[model samples]
Target: MKVSIITVVYNGAEHIRDCIESVLSQTYPDIEYIIIDGKSTDGTVAIVQAYGTKIARFVSEPDKGLYDAMNKGISMATGEVIGLLNADDFYRHDRVITNMVSLIEQTGSDAVYGDMLYVDRDDTQKLKRYWRSGWYSDNAFKWGWMPGHLSFFAKRTLYETCGLFRLDMKSAADYELLLRFIHKHKAKLSYMNEVTIVMRAGGISNSSLKNRLRANREDKLAWELNGLQPYFFTLWLKPLRKIRQYISKPPVKNAHS
Candidate 1:
């Protein structure tokens, strides 16, 4: 199956090259790589343009935000499956896409997701945390469990059926999307027990105490907007669950070390 990998970036000149190179280097030949830029003035567009036609599609324009750019990329995607990779993130290995497609075909599932590693922004080799996404359960969302969004690969039809990311949400849009897809809509999902993406340590939701609190409120609103009620402790458990990520480390050889 063909997979379309979308990278949404804004003024991310520093690391856009790494992200692009990672996608271009994928072992999967049927990948349609798309890059959506928010009219970056920091030479991010130039960096991406330097790749020329190697990038299947490139759009640089002013957008509402990260999720908006993602939406744009999704609308342009023609592949059978779609995956999102952030500008500051890269595939764990060259075969990440190859393995994802293989698993999807083998399991006959609508979606597939795997583990992720958060490495230092300056030194990617230095591990910051390990996000090991275990098997999915119907009630897992109640306990604040979600597969890594970067590692998530789903059919394009899922978005057309379930809907796209909410534009109003600041940080919890990804959380909300996953909740709707896996929980509310009950999309068939398969879990791969391996690391797929390596992300930069800092994330918007966990960037600061204030942002974290805001994200918590948005997360609760996510459930409310979907007409689904989460457990009273669900939001609380979400951040607390990260403790395990910090304590745990990826396997020595398997984590792209």
Candidate 2:
């Protein structure tokens, strides 16, 4: 099946090259790679442009915000599966997409996601933390369990059905989207233990304590908006889950396949 991967970037010149190279090197043959840039003045566009015609779609216009740009990419995707990769992140290996697509298709799952590593921004090889996502259950959200958004891949039709990420949310739109899909709509989902994406240390949602609190509010609202109730401690446990990731050792190089 054809898979469309999108990178939503803004002023990411330092990391865009590695992101582009990782996607371009994918062993999966039928892949459509797109970059949705936010009119960066920092020459990030130039680095993406350097790739020339290899990119299927390149949009370098201003958008409302990060999720807005992501929605744009989602609307443009026409492949059977759609995924997002930020400029500061790269796949674990060239066969990452190949393995994910195979598992997702074999199980007839609407979405698939797995583990990821948090690596240093300057040195991608230096691992900071291991985000090993366990299997999903019907009540996984009750315990504040969620798959890494960067590693999440879903069928294009699921977006058409469940709708795109909510723009109203500041940081927790991804969690809300997953809550709607897996918890509300009950999309068939899969979890492979392979370390999929390696992301840099910082991100918008966790940039500050204030941002994290804002994300907490949004996550609480996520369940309420879906007309579902979360456990009283759900929001608290969500952040607590990451503590173990920091304690575990990083996976072996070939553990994925």
Candidate 3:
């Protein structure tokens, strides 16, 4: 099946090449790579332009925000399945997409997600955290468990059915969307059991204590928006879950291995 990988970037010239190259290097033959840039003025557009048509769809324009650009990319995507890769992250290996497609076909699942690693921004080889996403359960969201968004891939029809990311949310939009799809809508999910993406450590939500608190508030709102109630400890457990990831180490063989 053809997969569409979307990368939304803004003023990310320093690492956009790595993100783009990772998609270009995928072992899977049928991939439609789409990049939505937020009118980057820092030469990010030039770097992506250097690749020419290798990138199937490139849009560089001012957007509302991160999730807005992502919504635009999703609208443009035309493939059996779609996945989002951030500008500061890259696929774990050339065959990550291959594995995702294989598992989706095998399990006949609406979505598939695997593990992820958090490495230093300057030195990706230096592992900082290992997010091993275990199997999904019916009450996973109630316990604040979620698969890595970067490693998650879902059928295009799922998006057509459930809807796209909310523009109002600042940080927890991804969590909200996943909660809606997997928990509320009951989308059939499959676990890939491997690291699918290597992400840079500094993310918006975790960059500051204030931002984290804001994200916590938004996370609570995520459940309320869906007309669902999270356990009292749910939002607390969400950030607390990452504490274990920081101490966890990657296995000998992962997607890159």
Candidate 4:
């Protein structure tokens, strides 16, 4: 099955090139690489254009925000399976997408996910945090457990049924979409207990205490909008779950250590 990878970026000159190269390097030859740029003024577009025909579609235009750009990419994706990779993230290896395809096909799963590593922005070789997403269960959502969206791949048709990201949600749209599809709709999903994406430390969701608080409110609203009720301590447990990530580091990637 063909896989479509979408990358939404804005002023990501520092990391966008590597992100593009990673998508192009996927061992799965039938990948349709789509890049959505919010009219980046920092020369991100030039680098994307440099890739030329290697990329399937490159959309450069003004957008409302991150989720809006994501929705646009989803609408344009033509491949059987669709996945998103941010500008500041990259596949753990060239075989990442190939592995994802094999797992999803083997299980006939509508969606599949894996783990991620958060590395130092200045040094990608140093793994700062490890996000190991265990197998999914409806009950886990109540406790605020979620798989890293970076490694989640879903069938394109599923989006039509579960719907796209909510524009009203500033920071929690991805969470809401996953909750809606997997928890509520019970989409067929499989988990690969391996790390496939490495994220650069720091992002809008966790950039500040204030921003995190705002995201919390959005998350709560996500439950409310779906007519679902979370455990009273659900939101509180979410951040607490991430505490271990700050202390537990992964094996260093540097050679000749």
Minimal lDDT window, size 10, model 4? 248-257
Q: lDDT per residue, candidate 3, 178-239, as tens digits?
A: 99999999999999998889999886746578878888889988999999998899998988
The TM-score measured for candidate 4 stands at 0.94
Residue 21's lDDT in candidate 3: 92
Name the lDDT value of residue 70 in candidate 1: 98
User: What TM-score goes with each of the models?
Assistant: 0.96, 0.96, 0.96, 0.94
Runs of candidate 2 with Cα error greater than 4 angstroms are 205-211, 255-257
Q: Judged by lDDT against the true structure, how good is candidate 2?
A: 0.90
Compared with the true structure, the alpha-carbon lDDT of candidate 3 equals: 0.92
Deviation from truth (RMSD, Å), model 1: 1.8
Total clashes for model 2:
0
Off by over 4 Å in 3: 207-209, 255-257
Candidate 1 residue 252 Cα shift, in angstroms, is 2.8
RMSD of each: 1.8, 1.4, 1.5, 2.8
CA displacement after TM-score superposition, residue 49 of candidate 1 (Å): 1.2
Q: After superposition, how far is residue 27 of candidate 3 from its true place, in Å?
A: 0.8
Q: Model 4 clash tally?
A: 0
Worst 10 residues of 3 by lDDT: 248-257
